[model samples]
Target: MRFPFARVVSLVVAVALLLSAVSGFFALFTARWRVASLPGTQQVANHTFTEQIIVGEYRTCVTLRRETPATNDSDVVQVRREENCYNTFPVNLFWSSRLRDVSTGEKAYFIGVCWINRDRVARVLGIPEDVPMQSLWKRQCFGVRSASVGTQAVAAAMAVIGGAVLIFDRNDKERPYRGMILIAGLTAALSLVPLVIWFGVVKKPGFDVGPSLRLAGFTWGIHLASFLALTLLHFCHSRSEMARYSGPPIDREVVTTQTADRLTPTQARAGQAAEGFARLESQA
Candidate 1:
């Protein structure tokens, strides 16, 4: 029997998409985005301290290390470290954000925790309540948080749907569906748009500058892999369709009958030779 290479490839693509989608979905819950060590000097009775901040889509961790002189004459210092990890509320803030339709000037309010008015994040981070925050930060949060969470969710869902479609379409290669490539392409687009939006909003040169901030983290990489896998799956379907349609069609049943007919004469000649040998043996 012939090896089912095409079926194997199709199944492999499906599995790749499923794995990528699962990773992408879980990446949303992790916090490994921007990692930095911020050093500061404070005149607290002749002591200095430094801080490290690690930020991510869903979480943030801060570590403060205080260094004090061990001895007045010694060059060594004693170190004290404190670390705490907390969940970021970007998506939560976005949920509380008011919605407005620009075209119709219609406005609707969401009933949830008022993150801005409550301002618990600043307090949690030890920022003074009297300090004013830039209005631009809210806008940035709206754009970055909304796109990161919303688009990733859509992309992951689309990828899962695409994987299921590929699995179901594997057996119908002889009469391939015309919509397979279209669905696969749409799935790729679903993954691609989120990546583009994320890059544009959060990863901009002007917005994301400085040594403390980074372009992306593991979540974005997972999304990229999901997009690439879906794109390759789309191309696979397209190539299969092109190969199936490009050549002249042949009837397998008719070809098999013709091959058997061509072999009949040879089979008859062999039978006659065997009969002659048997007659010679009988006569002897």
Candidate 2:
């Protein structure tokens, strides 16, 4: 049987999407325990720190995840410890940021907490009243700083590339589904901005660049696979539709039958020879 390449490709796409989503969550929350506030999630005002105006407003905005690791002990301990390591490695925040300081209106970079989602935002743009922004600024959060042109360059590049991928997929016969894939990917990629803004990685900005390369990579990977699948699917569909109306053959079918009435002496001799050979082999 032929290998299940289509199913295999689909599985690869599914796995990649799951991974992209998982990493997205990790970037959002820094860690399972660290405080975070996602778009729809409920926020529990963790804590607030006020130091100097320079630090801006910093607070431990906490949110929840569906599942978390209490400890490294589980039924699949070996698998968790060894294979498919998700939360073990360090998560970096510089890749995707939307940080800004209302006071100076800068990219707001905090020294010690620089890129690890630990950067102290000067004054977070959209903080719910339930979460403290003013008091946090008074308290010394990590000293926030501004986003450099290089960082901005990368963000702009990601968005442009993401857009280009979408366009190419449109004209491309090989990947008709590029638009849907890009939509999913860009949306997921954008999920990192709040952290960016909160972390002061991006300046009060134009285009408000999307997630960093790290997160973008996952979405892009899945997007490519999905785009290819969509293209193949459409191509197959077209071929099938064409086959339906292809019409019948212009020529009619003919059949021939064998009869004992016709036989030549040479043919009979050849037949006798074949029989003789078979009889000789059997006897031998």
Candidate 3:
């Protein structure tokens, strides 16, 4: 039995694209885009909390860890970790300082650790100045975050559509592959936009805090993979199309060439008589 090799290959490519596209959306939900470990400790009452900040497209979180001193008898220490997360944007996009807590008269301070140096994070967050905080949450930063979210969402959506189209249009007969390739191109572009925006934003001078803030998160890697897959798929389709259109001519009957090269003398004479009869019949 012969296997349907082309169909199987198409299905595999579509499945891969679908999975990567779905995973790309995790960038919006995952809080691992940019990471930094601050140098100093925060003293809240009796506990001194060491800080690490994690920024995502939509939300940013800080993990504060405190360790109890080991006793003389035993070297074991007790450690407690606390995490606080806040929306990247406030109730209003313009608001920069304190984030409103659920309970009355309680507030959580929001700071952009992306710009703060490791040693300066403590001082920056400690001070209650409105002006510098406003500078940190610049309108441009908010715009970039918003744009990244939008492009990533659209890229994932386009990838889903492309996969569905590939699955449904099984036979290249309806010629929807062109549309599929176009969708792939769109998906690639959309996926690329977020990567460019975030990479550039993170590499900007201010975000380069001491100890080097790393963009070593899963979301960025996923986005990069999705972009590469979509791009490679697009070019593959284009090359296949070019080959299909520019391929050798289809088989056709040529009595003159065939009779001369492939027929016996008796067969050649019969072919000539048949051609003459066919012409006569058409004239009649």
Candidate 4:
């Protein structure tokens, strides 16, 4: 069955926004993950956590610099032999602090990592060593989208409202338009959030030639698609209204009552007869 064009548009937009924003976020995360995995990220310690790590399912220490010019993989291996607790794992989104144990000459590693699967994480690594990894996990997980729940809430409101405005009209007598508006607006606003997150909010760092550029190009497409959906909605609504009313074509005329001149002769005689009958009955 054919649904309202507005609803269709809103749904599509919402989907695109969700996919892209989520895609971009993951892209950003993936990019960060890529940065983490890059062979050269670690630098000489600055006394505490100065390196970036991932946040989510599995938190791992990342070298802070997106691509460090000075550091090499050989150097990392050499440094590992010297430090006992500083076992190198996969790199991620959060930054790690460096601390040296004076008594044991063991450099303690503290890098926050968010794993790929945020909802269901594997057995958390680094718990065995009594290193403060859990606290680190909490901090990194929240940053996956934004710092506060309020941001998502605001984005949700935007999607809800905008979708509503674009979808439903007040004059729709056939069905309740208000609820449609609520759903459409809600979805639209929510859909655009991911785009806002990736393209607008968090600008990922620039890196050298590879799949990263390709990903950036794809994200740009996502942004375009989102804006286009909104624009199409406006056009569709205007066209629909134009088709619906057709410039106030013909006004229906209201029919009113015309007064009768007088009663028919047959009606008058009948009335006289009825009066006589009533008088006779009363006398009897």
Candidate with the greatest TM-score versus the true structure: 3
In model 2, state the lDDT of residue 105. 38
Candidate 2 wrongly placed segments (more than 4 Å): 1-3, 31-201, 204-213, 240-245, 248-284
lDDT string, candidate 3, 1-284, tens digits: 64354455556656756775657765556766655555545443344453566656655555656578899998988888766565654546554555333213256565444443322333323322221323334533657767877887787787777677667776643233556656766676677776676566543322333211122233334434544554565566668877889655545555546548877889888988999999999999
Q: Could you give candidate 4's per-residue lDDT for residues 1-284 as a string of tens digits?
A: 87665556666665555554444444443333222222333332332222333322222333322222345544442222221222222344354435443223355445433444321121222112222334434443556344322343454455445434444443452232444444444544444444444343333333222343345345447546655555655666667778888453343332111111265778778877998999999999
Q: How accurate locally is residue 72 in candidate 4, as Cα lDDT from 0 to 100?
A: 57
TM-score of each: 0.54, 0.28, 0.57, 0.34
Q: Rank the candidates by TM-score, best first.
A: 3, 1, 4, 2
Better of 3 and 4 by lDDT: 3
What residue pairs are clashing in model 3?
none
Q: Compared with the true structure, what per-residue lDDT tens digits does model 1 show for residues 1-284?
A: 65365555556656766776776666555554444444344221124233554545555454545567678688788787655454446445454333332223354443322244325443333222232322323533575665666766776676677668767765544222446445545555555554554455444122223222222233344444544554565567778878878665689988976766777787968877998999999999
Using lDDT as the measure, what is the rank order of every candidate, best first? Answer: 3, 1, 4, 2
Q: Model-by-model lDDT, in order? A: 0.51, 0.38, 0.55, 0.41
Q: Which candidate, 1 or 4, would have the higher TM-score against the true structure?
A: 1
Candidate 2 global TM-score: 0.28
Winner of 2 and 3 under lDDT: 3
lDDT of 2 by residue, 148-240 (tens): 212323433444444444443333233335454555445444443434444453232211223333443454455455445555765675786
